[model samples]
Target: KISAIANEYGLSVDLQTKVWQLTVGQQQRVEILKALYREVDILIMDEPTSVLTPQEVDQLFTTLRTLVDDGLTIIFITHKLDEVMQVSDRVTVLRKGKVVATILTTKTDKPSLARLMVGREVIFRLEKSRLERREKILEVNNLQALNDRGIPAIRGVSFDLFGGEILGVAGVSGNGQHELAEALTGLRKSTKGRVFLGKKDVTNSSAREMNDLNVAHIPAERIRIGVVPALSIRENLILKKYRHSPFSYGEFLDNKEIEENACRAISDYHIDAPSCETPVKLLSGGNIQKVVLARELSENPGLIVAVHPTYGLDIGATEQVRQVLLAQRERGAAT
Candidate 1:
């Protein structure tokens, strides 16, 4: 019966598959199937398309439309105005725990909805400088790596990124994008080929070595790999530079300098926290991402390897992250 339903909805996922093995889109499909399997009258999706690829998003929208046609009610909740415009028949604008408006999708536009939700005009487009490709910053030649299951993930991937360039690795979640990023950042070992930082062959170098080369990485799993959640924001901000002169003096940490550094980062990155002493785990996802960005991009590293940088951030946070990356590119950093 489940197979039949899955077939009907174009959901071909294996019921026996482990959650860890599934892609972000497949995980979302599983969640949708779980709800549908119960024969529910109404479905409420909160940011269902947050981590899906472009293809997965279109497939999901098709499936949702089909379900709606078959008399199922779906409440799709997301901060993305574009998604709302595409998939919703009606959109409800809520601000400060109150509904400002609930109108038909055709009756309004993204700009109108943005104004209603935020009480101000939101700019969706950004002004980017002309592209001027510079010297090669990162060169991956025939790189190969494995995933956690001891299976081949990144298979002989080769790419060259120049300074002031943003090379996007686009594929579904289960693909080797994760492993490739890890191999480049030295979080995963490559069985073959070499990675070059300019003329330096730095393949299979440790994360510390990569750091020494000034290779900044904003990991996909931000909570797990990006920041130490139990640590205070101040400590997390200085996680990379703690052993340096300003943060440390021989064997002891200079608390005053560290606090000042944290304060500066908090203000610069617009991190919303009661204080720098606040634990990172207590802050919102967007703020946590900001902390990660603050730490990674603070030094203006040569190569910025960001995997799903704005994965779970809200609209405003998402735009902020994109702008930051663009700003980095403008300064001749390769992303």
Candidate 2:
């Protein structure tokens, strides 16, 4: 029965293959097949395309339409407004545990929906003016790194980033993108070559040293590298600056200064939280991303290293993040 449902949805799976070896898209298919096998009338998917590539998202959408045609009802819960517009027949907007509006997808536009969801006017697009490229501020010379298994991941990669420019690194998963970002941010050691931050050889420097040099990093994994899950938003905001002045005195932290910073960040970044004292883990994914952005970008570093900055964000949040990056670039920060 599972095989039949899989075939009907245009899903291909190997019964002999272990679940751990399956791709993310294949795992999603398996999940759908399990629900179909149980003869459920409705299927609910939460942030289904959060980790998928463009092609994978298209494939998933095709399978969803096929299932819907076969009399299966699907409820896709996602922050991505574009996906909702493309797939949903009717859309429901919720804010702070209350239904704001329920309108037909064909009747509403992205801006209108965003306003309903955020309770304020949202900018859908950003106007980015071109800036004359400045001298190279960061340079990676034949950088190499190893993955967690001590296997070679990055090999002899080199690049130069200039002020007033955004250099985008694109590649398939496991092609050393993560390793490269980590090495550049000093989170991982380079096996060869050197990294120059404006004539300073900072290769294999500690994370603290990189931060002290005014380098900001927005990691791909928010829960793991971005913020502490167990800490409050106020506490997490001061993670990097707690030992410095204003936030600390001698060896003790200044709670009042930390709280003030958190409150200011929350307002400036438009982070939706009950209070600055709220634990970061309890906030939604989009809100957590806002916290990370607020903390990193607020520092106004000389260079910004961002990995998938808008990976799991909604259209509104994605636009905000992009604008922030653009603003940093305009301020002569190499992004």
lDDT of each: 0.89, 0.85
The C-alpha stretches of model 2 lying farther than 4 A from their native spots are: 1-41
**In model 1, where do residues sit more than 4 Å from their true spots?**
96-98
Worst 10 residues of 2 by lDDT: 20-29
| Every candidate's CA RMSD | 2.0, 3.5
Best by TM-score: 1
- Residue 165 of model 2, lDDT score: 90
Residue 255 displacement (Å), model 2: 2.1
Model 1: per-residue Cα lDDT over 61-130, one tens digit each: 9999988999999999888888999999988887756999999999999889888976877668988989
Against the correct fold, how does model 1 do in TM-score? 0.92
